[model samples]
Target: MPSGESGHALKVESWGDPSILVTEFPDIEDFHGQLIETVLRLEQDPEFTRHFDGHVGESKVYHVERWDCPAARLIDARAKALFTSALKKENAVVDLSWASVYRAGNYCLPHSHFRSAASLVYFLDLGDEEAGGRFLFTDPRLKICCRHEPGRMTYPVGPQVRPGILMMFPAQCVHMVTPYHGTRPRITMSWNIDDKALPGNPLPN
Candidate 1:
């Protein structure tokens, strides 16, 4: 993919009722390498804590406010831009930012982010395409699942997973990841954001 003068190529696509924004950053090899290394190093640090909840299975996810890495900041800027463009709202701020590292047998259950106007997931390293860690979004309506035929309703549709692809959707959209079976780890970064700054959660500097 040919990049712009700034060496950053972006392509944005939006769909669905609430609108899901899928942005492709096709030229960021160096930035991705730096970010992957940074996250791996942090994982090995004894002081860096990992978080787990009922929604995740054997995966490492943690919040970070002080991660001032240039690659991360670049992602933040792009996310804010996409948010504003899609929602026609300005001064959007990231309420929470986190990184997720998933090994074999790791997955996330269907859930939605609360208190957020929107949320995004950036695919850093999707290990194996056939290893079955596809991201899925369930239809919010209960009537969709009642159909007897399988192909009739496309409720749990997902985008093609690839590196440097960022997907932003409404906060209420319930999404999840299937169990991964690849030998290599699957890595991703996420953010919970709103149109404006929240009371206690401030934007990253």
Candidate 2:
């Protein structure tokens, strides 16, 4: 954790041994490739146009966001269980959506989720032995990019990216994927949770 984030920010804690916990479950289940392929095909289909570059530096080409996907729903169910078990919030819901990212010449900007409790990313097809597509945090530490640590310990968030995995963290964490020079496109799924389902223009208590 960074300085100045104390008190006002949440802190990470030990699992089972402590009250609040942070856990990491690896290989929870292998994602079906066909399900991933089907979603990818839909995103690539001309009818489902890709979003235009936002005029930012090296803007990545992304498939128009997808929310009504069966595949996405499947992942949501699993993620909900994971989140609930980890956070001890049994009633928590894993709200999320799908989006195919086409990484060419290395793209993606640093940003955080606007209205989410937590955000996640699932690597579907990031083909490369030496490709960089890490889920980075704003702080140099607490980095999800460094390496596969045994426990759910915090590290620096720098230029590190991996594939064939699902990563979850606070929604406020600033993150971005590094460029990929792989032959195949980098496809992934991302989403966040909205526990309250609050009404629009929520009134104060």
Candidate 3:
């Protein structure tokens, strides 16, 4: 833990903890609108929600490539810069993209992307209020012992995640979302990054 971020307070500091990070810009819209459309479609699939705990609508497979859509282009370019800088690499490459949409009472189970170096989640709507869906990341160091008492041991300590927030964290860190109780569905874009993905080449694990 770095400086005053460790103890019992819920502060969103870098802390030099390679396992988590959060960036925010709540106003940027998904220009191509595929994210919104995808969320709506996925919500109708019964098989999808049960298959992956309310997750569906995975982005098309691409070879570390960028799409013509403005939002895709932004994620491709800006995300690459963010990943490369965070991982201290010159050619960080995104492996693939996926999405999830959660309605009232839907949620994801705690899990980790153990195969990837880093992972990212771009939120469209983080639910309506604190009563709705809340993204949580268990501290890997003390996940087993951590408590979820409000104003005491905020089990998942994270930054204020509004729309357009791009959250990046170590792929091996355990995280999950609390059940959403909002009227609207919660939408997000998730992708893994590989620092070994050189230009014009497949990513190396």
For TM-score, the strongest prediction is: 1
Where is model 2 more than 4 Å wrong at Cα? 1-31, 45-50, 54-72, 140-163, 199-205
Tens digits of lDDT, candidate 2, 61-158: 23223435555455556555545555666465434354546555555677666566766666666656566555445433342333465334445353
Q: Which stretches of candidate 1 lie over 4 Å from their true place?
A: 1-9, 15-18, 46-48, 53-65, 141-155, 200-205
Superior candidate under TM-score, 1 versus 3: 1
TM-scores, all candidates, are 0.81, 0.61, 0.67
lDDT of 2 at 68: 51
Question: Best candidate per lDDT, number?
Answer: 1
Ordered by lDDT, highest first, the candidates read 1, 3, 2
**Each model's total of backbone clashes:** 0, 11, 0
Q: Per-prediction RMSD in angstroms?
A: 4.6, 10.5, 8.6
Q: For residues 71-124, could you state the per-residue lDDT of candidate 3 as single tens digits?
A: 555555655666766557777766665556666777766777645688887777
lDDT of 2 at 158: 38
Q: Candidate 1, residues 36-135: lDDT per residue as tens digits?
A: 8777777765455364542464434445545657776677677777777767886677788777888787888887886779998889999877997788
Model 1 sits at a Cα RMSD from the real structure of 4.6
